[model samples]
Every structure is written in C-alpha cells, then in structure tokens.
Target: MTAAGLPMEIRSEGLPTRVRIHEVGARDGLQNERTVVPTEVKAEFIHRLAAAGLPTVEATSFVHPKWVPQLADAEQLFPLLGDLDPQRLPVLVPNERGLDRALALGARRIAVFGSATESFAKANLNRTVDEALAMFAPVITRAKDAGVEVRGYLSMCFGDPWEGPVPVAQTVRVCRALLDLGCDELSLGDTIGVATPGHVQTLLAALNEAGVPTSRIGVHFHDTYGQALANTFAALQHGITTIDASAGGLGGCPYAKSATGNLATEDLVWMLHGLGIETGVDLDRLTATSVWMAEALGRPSPSRTLRALSHKE
Candidate 1:
C-alpha cells in the first residue's frame, strides 16, 4: 500500500494527514561537491531514490557549465536517465536557455529559483531579486505554453549570507511575485539554515495573511543547527503539506558558509511516519538508499537516526 493508504487517525494535532516529499539529493545535494560525480553514478543514485518510492525527485540542473561545473554533464545525464519513470523526475532550469535545453532533452518538469534577499539574489543569480523575478517571467510563460510543469523556488527565505535576518514581508513579496508569474508551486527555502520554530511560524503566518494558500507552499529547511525537524513541524502546524529534503543530509547552501547540510530524508521520514503523516515513502527502503548514497559519496550518512538504527541492526 502507498503511504496515502495508511490510517490517518494517528496524525499529530493540526498536522496535515498527508505530505509530499520532493527529493533533491541528485541535484541540489550534489551541485556543491568539489569532485564531479560520474553521470552513471548519478543515474544509479536516482534509480535507488525511485525504488525508495519518492514521488518527485529533482534529477539535475540545466545551468551553464561555467557557473556549476558539477552539473556540466546534464545533457549527458538526462539521456542516461531515460530509463527512469518519467512521472517522478524533474530538472532544474535556471533560465529560458536552460529551460530550452531541458525541453530539447524532453524534460516535462522544471524548477526556477529566486531569492528573498537582495544580496543572495545578486550573488547566486547575478541579479537583484526583482531582476531575477523578471527574468523568470518569460521562462515561466514559455514553459506554460509548452505544457511543462514549473516549480518556483524562493531561496534564503529565513536568512541571507550577506544580509542578516530576512524579513517575513520580503519573503511574502517574493512568493507573491512567483505565484503571479504562474508557478504551479513554490518552495520556500531556509538557505542558511538559521530558522527556528518561531521564525517558521512568523513567516507562514505572514504568507497566509497575504492570501497565499498553504497547499501551494513547500518548505525547504537545512539542518545547520539541528533545527530543521523542529521548523518542519512548525510548518506542518501551519498547514504546509509539502517539503524538500536531501537524502542522508547530502546538500548545503553554496552562498552561506555557516550553513550545514539539508534535512536528512531518513530523519524526516522517521518523524513523519511516527506522526502518521502519509508520505508514500518506505522508511526502511529510504534508510537503505541513504546508506548506499553515503557509501557512494565516501562519507558517513549525516542522519543521526539512520546511523543509530544501522548500529542497532
């Protein structure tokens, strides 16, 4: 049975009975690595994630090789991933050119990212926040015309690297812009992993008040200070039903030096299952996938829960 088939009576108070997990280990998780992961290895990692029952996985980014050489194999990787179940894979497209490349390679889904903080926008995309939003408009329109599903990302929603704390107002404004641009869904990112439960509550409240439905907002938290799970719970209380996580805590923010890895998929699934939240993911299978990915990366799995469970076994 899928996770949605599970009994829902055990869910936490105020928590959504079901949640969607957008796995990003193959793309966001690997983008910052110094060593280039071979295209075959990347494809194999994605296959393992699919076997773990992830409904959506960000397969790779279609950015310029000059900016992120780790994903320079995108053109090669996409074709290699042709064997994957097309219903689950989405590629990141940084601009119209990137989207065009993805389309040429037969990509059906794409993600465009902007930032709530001006400095982060400038540093990451070489444009101001508004400029980045403006840049995405044409891309979003063209993609819609092509019948491609588009997901928007608002990075540094909680805090910025150059600037200190980000205002809730700023995040809401960026979110409104992305929605107005016709993005199907928006992932609000805690780029630096500096958010607390209070910050999550405040931001969600502001977004809610601004007329953004919780169903359209997805939370992407980093576990830099071990606050990811807490923030995620807080988001759930505010009616968020979708989350973005990396396998084995595999990713970190490139713009924030102090930021650690993303929320571990094993840990998140463990918590969600305990809460009886349906995620359509098998915890045991996901834990095994995390272990395999860690071995492939030549690093210990960053999930404490997975490590402890493995030790017990």
Candidate 2:
C-alpha cells in the first residue's frame, strides 16, 4: 500500500487493460435494505457513484412496489437522475409492465433478472425456470425494439441452497437462451456465493463452448464463502471484463438466506488496481462514498478494503 492508501501498481499478464465495473450499489445494494432509503438519498448515492467515475451504475428497479418496497420510489428517483447519462443508469425491469414503467421514465438501458435453477426461479420469480425465461423474452424483445440495451442477470449460476451445486451445462443452456432472447450481455451470478476459482473457470469455459463469447459476459460473485475475489480473478484470466459490485459490500439475495454481500467495489478495485487494470474510478472518492453510505445505513461496511482505507482516512 502507498502512503495515500492506494495499492502498488503491478500489471498482470494477459488481463484486460481496462475493466468496466457495473456498479450496483444504489439499485442492488439498497434494494436489500431492511428499511426504505429516502428517494433523495438514493438519488444522491447514484450521483456520488457517477462522480466517482463508475461508468455504469444501476440506478433503480421498476419492479412492482408490492414486490420490492425498498425501490418503490423508482418513479420518483429516476427523474432526479436526468442530469446523468441515461445509458449509464441502467434499471431493472422484471416484466413487460416493468419495462413500460422504465421506458416511460426514459430509461435507455434495462436489465432482466432470471434464475439458472428451478428452486430459485420458483422462490424468486414464482415460476419455473422455463416460465421465467418466457416472461423475460417479451420484456427483452420490447426493450430492444425501443432501442434500449438489455442485460440478463442469471442468479445461482454456481450453487443453490435448495438445489445444491448447479450443473455447468444447465447454466450454459440458460445463458444461451437469454442471449438468444436478445439480451446484450449476461451477468453470471453466484448468488449463494459457493463458487471457487475452478468452478468459475469451468462455467466460463462451458459458456464459451456454448457459443457465448467472453466479451458479452460479466461476473457477479458474492463473498459468502470468502472466495469472491478469487473467483473474480479466475474470470479475469478467462477474459471476462464486466463485473458487478456493490459499494461498501452491501446486498445479498433477499430470497436466498445463505447469500451474503456482493463482491465489494472497494475490494475489487484494490485487486484490479494492484494488477494495474484500469477502471476509471477514483478509489478515495468511492471509499468515502461507501463510508458515507454505511453511516446512513447505521452499520459498518462489510468491505475489508473499505474498513482498512477509511481507518487510515
């Protein structure tokens, strides 16, 4: 570490020179909050993320308020973010109605959340795996017709609490389906965080063999078993560039009790910078933002790097 709390730059062999971090703090992070954050605070959090140079920050979800009350203020919150680039502020749209809500608000980019396992599909979406994919098909098609970019989030790509270890073939089939349905990118989510480095590489290779290119793939790993960073490095070695991370190590699958916080932005950035990878983010500013958010949430951040750097500050 340097005197300023930054990591020493040491370039890694054959890694992408730059990585696009799809910051999910405001949308994914706060959605799991026990209490509903004030709409203005959510707006401010997004502004801070953008100012910290996160290229794509998921702004909010247009899911029905009955489902996710934490983001019930999506309609009110999105307008406040008009000052930011709409393309960079992707929102989650669960169905056609959700897509209509997001489009009415002028969301230029949207994401559809799905599951790779039957249990998660039923528990999270109240449908079978195939049924959930069918539901997303029209939503994705409509988004594409409207010229809105769509990202597919496939949770439980590695293991499921109910189903145990998910098969690589099963994951690749669903990934290809989502891509076939017109999703511009797919974020492989180890929702219960049971993935190790080898499992990650295996899944990535399976997807590649199934004709899903690494350039169109991103990884979202949870740190439940303390393997998120290691799994991420495995993906990096396979040429997967986009990563989904939450600030302050916030967010877990509300439907999956065993799931924990996502791969923390602070932790990921520390590793990426140490490897001399470019993320275009201001580490100090991002850490400060997470610290501020931790205070607002009335808890200490779970991020090791955030805690360490903030202590020095």
Candidate 3:
C-alpha cells in the first residue's frame, strides 16, 4: 500500500470504464444526526463535495421539519447553492406538497423515497406499499410535466427489519411499479445491509428479466454487514453505473432500527480508482471533505478509507 493508503491500479475486464457516483452525504448523511448542523455549515458541506469532483450531490430534502428535523433547513440551505448546476443537485420530495416546496426553490432534479416491503412502508410512510406508490404517482407526473428529472429510492430491497428477507419477485414488482409511475431511474437500497454478492447478482438478473434495464438502476448498499463493496462489485459486473454513497459513511434509516451507515464514498472511490474505473472523483479531496465534515459533527468518520488516509496525514 502507498503512504496515502491508495491501492495499486489494476483494470478489471467486464467492468464499466466509468461510474457515476450519486453523493448523498449532504442530505442522507446529515438527516439522521441528532446534532443540528447550521444552514451555513450544510451549504459549505455541499460546496466542498462539489469542489471535490462529486458531480451529483443530493442537496437536501423537502420533507417536513416534523419528519426530519435535521434537514429542516432545506429551504434556507438550497438557495445558497445557486451557483452549482441545478441538474447536479437533487432534492428529496416525499409527496405533492414536498414537490411543491422543492419546485418553489427551482430544484431541477428530485427523488422520491419508497419501500419494497409492507412493514417498512407502514413504518416509514404510515401507508401501505400500494398507497405510498399512489402518493408518489401525482408527484412524479407533475415533476415530469415540469421537466424535472425524478429518481425513485426503493428501500429494503434485499431485507427488512420487521419483514425479514424480502423476495426477489416482491422487490421486482415495486421496482417495475416505480418505473411505470415515471421515475427516470431507480435506486435499489440494501437498507439493513443483509445482501450477499450472489443475492445482488440474482436481483439484477431478475430485474433485467422483468424488463428493467441495468442502465436505469443504481445500487445503495449500507455497510452494516460489511458487504457493501462486495455487493457493489457484483452490480458493476451487471452493468450498473450509478451508485449511491455517503461521504465518511454517514447515514442510516431512521425508520429501520437495524439499518446502518451507507457505503462510504471514500471506500467506493478508492475501490473504483484501484480497479482503473473512472469516477471523475479526486480521492484526496473527497477524503479531506469527509474529515472536515467529521470534525463539524464533533466525531471521527466511520469510513475505513477516510480513517486510514487521514491517520497517515
């Protein structure tokens, strides 16, 4: 290993030449924090992420403050990022009202959160899976009409806390429903992080068989069981180019008790770069940003790559 902790480059065959990282630290990373970060600090965090070469950064969520009090400054924080490309900054909208709030702020891209299981749907949305899909239909339609791109986040795709292991067909059904409802792309979330690499490949193959192209899908894997990277490699082998990651491995489902922090962007980038895959991300800069954010939160980052690199410094 190098002094900076970077792995030696080795290009692997059958993997995409480049991958698009969907940075969720600004939103997902901070949303679960009990410590309320100031609006200015949140804005700086996004700015740092963008400067670090993260092309797509999820800015904030338009969900009500009562639901996610940490991101309650969405309104105040979004406007401050006016200088960034609007298409690169995606916000989360829970319903028509959330979409309205986001549209008012000139958000050009947005994402809707959903679940593949009944238990998570009821716990997170207080609605059945079908009812939740119904709620997102109008919001997605309106977003399409407004010419805004919409992404669908399907949580508990592999397993659920209350529902144990989810069936592949059950997950595929919701994925198809989200695509049919007009989502531009879908993110399959291993929320409780129980997915194995074989399970990942099986799900991708099943989705492809069900007519969902791998091009229109992304993988969001948490490191709860330490399978995030292994699962991500399985997805890359299946031609999935979009990945959802949190810098410094910060994030978890507030609704899912067993869920943990997402796959660390530093770890993902390190793996990508070492594999000779182009992600257009500067590893050093990204690691520094994570360290900075960790200090802001008054704690050390959980990302193994971040800890290793920062420790060497």
Candidate 4:
C-alpha cells in the first residue's frame, strides 16, 4: 500500500507518468478578474502555455458579453487562435446560443457548466439546478450531433458561498444528468475551495456507489482554504486520474465571495510527480510558463511550490 493506504499496484508504469493538464487560466482564471486582459495578451498567454507542453487548454468562453465582458472578444479571439493544433484548444459554452457560436467557429471540443448547489446555480446562471440541466440538454445534443466532444462541469460540488455545505447526492444527481446528456467527462469543481480529504473521500465513494466510473470523473479544485492539493491526493486515491488546473494559479468563481484561485498547475504537478503519478507534464517548463503569465498579469503566482521554487533561484 502507498502512504495514503491505497493499493500500490494501481501505480502507473513509470514514476510520475503523464496526466492530462487542462489549462484553464485563459478562460476560468481570467474570467473573474476585474481588469480586462487584452485580446493580444490572451492569445500570447495561450501560445506560451502551448509552448510549455500543455496539451489541452480552455481558450475562452462564449457567454453573453453582458454576463462576462472579459471574453466578449470570443469571436475575434477564436479566429486569432489561428491554426492551433485542433486537439489542444477547447472552449467553454454556457448554453445553446454559446454552443452555436462555438460550432460556427468550427470548435470541435467544448465545455458546459452547471452547479451542484441550488444557490450557486441561481446566482451564477440565474437558474435552479434542474433548470440549468434542462437548459444544457439541447446544447449537449446539438454538440454531439455536430461531432464535438463535450465536458460537463459540476460547480460548487464541495460547498457554496450561499448554501454552505452541499450534499453528495445533489452532486451525483448533477453528474448523472450531465453523463446522460452525453458529456465525455464530468469535472467536479470545489468552487469555494472548502473541500477536505474526508469530503473528497465521501463524494468519490458515493459516486462509485452510484456506479459512476472513476475514468469518467475529473477533479477541479480551488486553493481558497489551501486544501486543493490534499483533496487532489484524496481523489487520486479513489482512482481519479483527470485533473483541472490553471497556470500561475489563476481563476476563482466570480459568484463565490472571497474565493482564491484554482489549484496551481505547478503545485499539482509537483505533488503528482512526488507521488509517481504520470501527468505527462514538465514541471520546470510549467513553472516557467507560470512565471511568464504571472508577470504579464502583474501579480505574484498563488502557487506555493512555484513561489518557493522561484525564491530558490
């Protein structure tokens, strides 16, 4: 057994084998910022992330400009992306209208988000949990018909700013709804970063009991309470391999008060590497990218490991 008391036999072939790092800094990370990141800068950020060997990067969101003005340049930005390796770029779509916009731009991969918390759903999308699911059903069907791979997000899975502790059954219900709607993968988001290892264990166990396979689930965490990495380890213990992270520790829910950023790509990679989990990421290069982006954003990285490593230099 490993240090966490999980089976050692589940370890991958090589030490720290590659895991898919979903770069969400451009989309999830920047969306919450008060300042508008210039289109050119956003494009350059994506280029730099790709150069750092990140395979899948969420480039931008296609929400209504009134809702998220930061990504209002979605149309202009989409074309500017200019021949990105098609496999590397996935964009976020909020509803059928957003999906239509993405499909018109020839986007083959897309993501849709819903919330496990009723309050979060109403606050973020102005809809209830069931209403949000109903809204996305047609969008998911359209995307599948158009041959697009769809990823579903369950936000506020751990806790919500308004609702406090969220029940695991509610989260699983959302997950099953998305899966039924044909989402290729479902990412559980700890929107307020209130998740603990114990919570992660309970949720994953519940999902497993509900027959949701580990392969179809992904974990998206925030560092608001500094429990992201610990929670990540817990998810890994439950056989969850896919993880969502952002460069320079960028991103938090705009609807979540006093929320911090997503689990930093650098920190998550460091822990996964130490645990001999193959995330197929280059830690040194990832850190360099984080440093560059942090400089561009004019803020110090929130990644503990990145901050420490840079200090060592």
Candidate 5:
C-alpha cells in the first residue's frame, strides 16, 4: 500500500517506473529572486543542470522586461544555451509578443501560464479565465504551425489565496480549454501550496474521469505548509510521471504572499530514488548543485534532503 493508505493494486497499477523531472530553477526559481542574477551565471546554471542529467530545464521567460526584470536577458540567454538541446529548454511566453521573441531566437519549446481561479486570473494576468485562454489559443496555433511544442500551466488548481477552496470543476474546465487550444501538455499548479494528498488524488481522478490523459498532465507543487512531498506522492500513485521541481526550492509566487518556494528537487529525488524509480539524476551531484546555488543566493536551500546531506558536502 502507498503511504496514504491507498491500496497497492489500486495505486500501483500501471504506475510508471520512471518519472520525468522538469527543472524550473533557471526560470521559475530565479524569477522571484530579489537579486538580478548575472546573465552569464544564469547560462552556466542551465549548463550545469544539463550536465547533471536534467532532461528538461526551463531556461527563462520571454515576458516583458518590466514584468519580470530578473529575466530581462532572455534574448542573450537563449543563444548561450545553443549547446543544449533546443527542445529541452522551454521558455515561458506570456503571449504572442513573448512567443515572437522566443521564436525569433529559435526556441523549439514554450510554456504559457494561466490560472484556474478567476481572482488569480484578473490579478496575475489582468484578464478573465476565458480571456487568457483566448489569448493563448492563437499563440498555441502559431507555435504548432511553426513546429514548436507548447506546454500550458494552470495555477491555483487546488486552492487560491483569495478564492479559498477552488472547485474541481473550475480547474477541470480550464484544463480542457488549454488542451483544446492545441497545448501538448497541461501542468496543474498548487500555486498557494495548500493541496493535500486527498485533494490531489480527487482532482486527478476528476481529470481522468473527464477523459484527460494522465500522460498529458504534470503536477507543480509548492513546499509551503510542508505538504509538497505528500502531494507529490499522491500524484505518483495516480500514475503521474512528469513532476515539476525547482533545485534548492528556489521560487515563490510573486502574487501569492502566503506561498513558499517550489517542491525542492533534492527532496523529490530522495523519495523517487528510495522508491526504486529511475530519474537519471545523480543524487550527490544534484545535492551539490543546490548547495552551490545556495551559496550564490547568500542563504541556504529550503530542501530538507539537501540540508540532511550537507554534512557530507
């Protein structure tokens, strides 16, 4: 049986033996950081992550400089990462303008972020849920026509800071919208880090009942309230194989003050490795990378695994 008391046959059936970790420390992790990390440093971070065996690394976002000044060097950053697989570096594109910038720079993969709750949509994107999806529709089509893959991110899928408990149907509707708009994948985000394992299973079950393939979905969990690992375990039991993580737990929602950083990559890796799951990431190297970044940030990583292993480092 799974840790949550889920029956082994039920939770383990069709379970994937390997999980894909989508590294977002370069983009999402650093975007909210107070200091504007040097462009060269950011490029090196990406390269180091690839060398450490991360298959997919979110390099940076193409949002306007004014919106996220930390990633203002997206143009310069893209060219520096030419040595890495273009498809592995997915840049966040806010709209056609952002997508245009990435396409001009020859980026092959892009991600568009949206919200499941109306309050967050208006606050984060200054648009209603439908309006945001409408804007992404054309962007998805243009990217697809250009042979680029688009990934959709829906935040506040579990609980919104302002809206309290978000109904599952609301999140499901947004999930279907993104998929219908030609997105190849949808990442459900617990933006405020309020999700429990039960909530995760229920939502995934709802999405499954709605005929959304688990293969097309990914989970993005925040570490606040100390529930990130528990939530991730629930996602795994449901056969979810694509997990989003930030090395050193290096990001926070700019709009959600109650939220903390993402589920730490080291913490997730510890759990997956113990479960005999293959992630192709060297634990020692990954922990050292987090430590190196912690020093750069002038603090320490929020990852418990990293902390527990720091003595050896």
Candidate 6:
C-alpha cells in the first residue's frame, strides 16, 4: 500500500488486462440537469465521446419527457447519432412504450431499468420490487425478439436513499431476474454511493455464489462517499472488468441530493491506464472533451484529473 493507504494497482497480477467502460455521461450524466441542454449540443457531446473512442455510450433515455425534462428530446437526439455505430449507442428504456419508441428509431441496443430495493423501486418507478421485475419481463423478452440486445440496470444494489442498507441476497435475486429475462448484461448500480471496497468485494462474491458470471456483470458507482475508485479497484481485483463512468463527473442521482456525481471517466481512465490495463481511450482527447463539455455546461469539471490537466494547458 502507498503512504496514502490506498491499495496500489498491481501491474504483474490480480488486475484485468483490459476493461470496457460503459460511458453514461450523455444519458445518466445529463438527465437530471436543471439547465436544458440543446438537443444538438447533447448530440455533439455524445459524438465527442464516441470520437474519443468510448466503446459504449448511453446516448439517451426513452423515458417519458414529464419524468426527465432534460432528455425530453430523445427522439431528436437519437437521430443525430445516426453516424455512430448502432451497438456503441445504447438508450435507456423503462418499458415497452419506451422500447417501441427506441426501436422505431432504429435503436438496436437498449437498457432495461430495475431496482434491488423496494423503496427505490417505489420512489423511482412507482412500483414494488416484484412489480418492477414483472414490468421488465415482457420488455426484456420483446426487445430480445426484435434482435435488440438488452442491458439491465439494477439500482440501489448496495444501499438506497429511502431504505438504509440493501442485502446482498436481495441484489442477487434482482440481478438473476433481469438476466433470466434475457438481458445480455447487467450493470449493478450503487445508486446512493454508500458502497465501500469491502462492500464491493462482498457483493461480487455473493453474486458469484448466486451463479452470476463476472463476465456478465458491470459495476456503476457514485463518488458520493469518496469510495468509488477504491471500490472499483476492489472489483477489478475480484475479476470484474466492466465499469460505468461519466465524462467530467457529470451526473448525480435526483433522489439523493447529497450524493455527488457518478465516477468520472477521466479519473477511471487515469487509474486503469496507470495500472497497465487497456481501455482504448485517448486520455488527452478525452480530457480536452471534458474541458469542452465543462465550458458547454458553464462550470468547471469535477474530475480531479480533468482539473489538473486543464490547468496545465
């Protein structure tokens, strides 16, 4: 361990050789913003992310405009991403209605949202835990039949804002349902960011015991408790390679006011690259894009890497 007491990234072993970062800045990152970003600007931001070589960018959500006003123009925004590879741009779909809208617009890849805790499911989706999974069942099946790949999101895997700590078995059960519904992959989200390294390791180990392969799971973390990176490191050491991050640390959960933004892509890239793990991201170009995006948002980026690098210019 370093003098700072942080776990050092081991170059020789116990680390992934490559990591696939699922970029969520354009969708989850911007969804709750109070300011209305122009549809074209949102499109351009995604374009920049793709150009920076993000493997998968959550482009937009097909949820009702009344719920998330910021991304109300999903229809308009999706058309702008026509030039990007279809698989690289996945849109969030709450149910069949959202799924139909996305499919009508040529979206081949989509994400179905669920929750591990009943409190968050009720507050966010207005449905109980079982009800939410019931809702996602048909959505996931229909999407798969349409030749559209489905990625599942299970929020509040670690803890919930309304309900305190979530049980690992509850998380595993929810994840199993999503996968059984035929979701190609599942992103376990620490919606409130209350997860620590020990929590991360325990969760993954429990999921493994539940018969979920590490290859099919990705972790989405928030830096709210300042444990995102440490938790990610723990996950990596435990043989999980996929991670979800936002550019410039751009998103925060609307339900939790005290929570900070999602783990920053630049910050994750800095650590992964330093540890000799390949992510195929251009750090300099990505940093420039973050600076550009911060200017567009009319604020400095929250990424310490982006902040320090921005000052060097």
User: Which model, 2 or 3, shows the larger lDDT?
Assistant: 3
Each candidate's clash count: 0, 0, 0, 11, 0, 0
Residue 38 miss distance in model 5 (angstroms): 0.3
TM-scores for all predictions: 0.95, 0.99, 0.99, 0.93, 0.95, 0.96
Better of 2 and 6 by lDDT: 2
Poorly placed runs, candidate 1 (over 4 Å) = 1-10
User: What residue runs in model 5 are displaced by over 4 Å at the alpha carbon?
Assistant: 1-14
Candidate 4 residues 20-53, lDDT tens each? 7788989998998888889988998888788777
Instruction: Report the lDDT of model 6 for residue 285.
Output: 82
Instruction: Report the poorest 10 consecutive residues by lDDT, candidate 2.
Output: 304-313
Off by over 4 Å in 4: 1-17
Best-to-worst order by lDDT is 3, 2, 5, 6, 1, 4
Provide the lDDT at 260 for model 4: 82
lDDT of 5 by residue, 215-277 (tens): 999999998889999999999989999999999999988888887999999888878876767
Better of 4 and 6 by lDDT: 6
lDDT of predicted model 5: 0.91
Model 2 per-residue lDDT tens digits across residues 195-260: 999999999998888899999999999999999999999999999899999999999978999999
Residues 8-61 of candidate 3 have per-residue lDDT tens digits of: 889999999999999999998899999999999999999999999999999999
Off by over 4 Å in 3: 2-5
**Residue 287 in candidate 4, Cα distance off native in Å:** 1.7
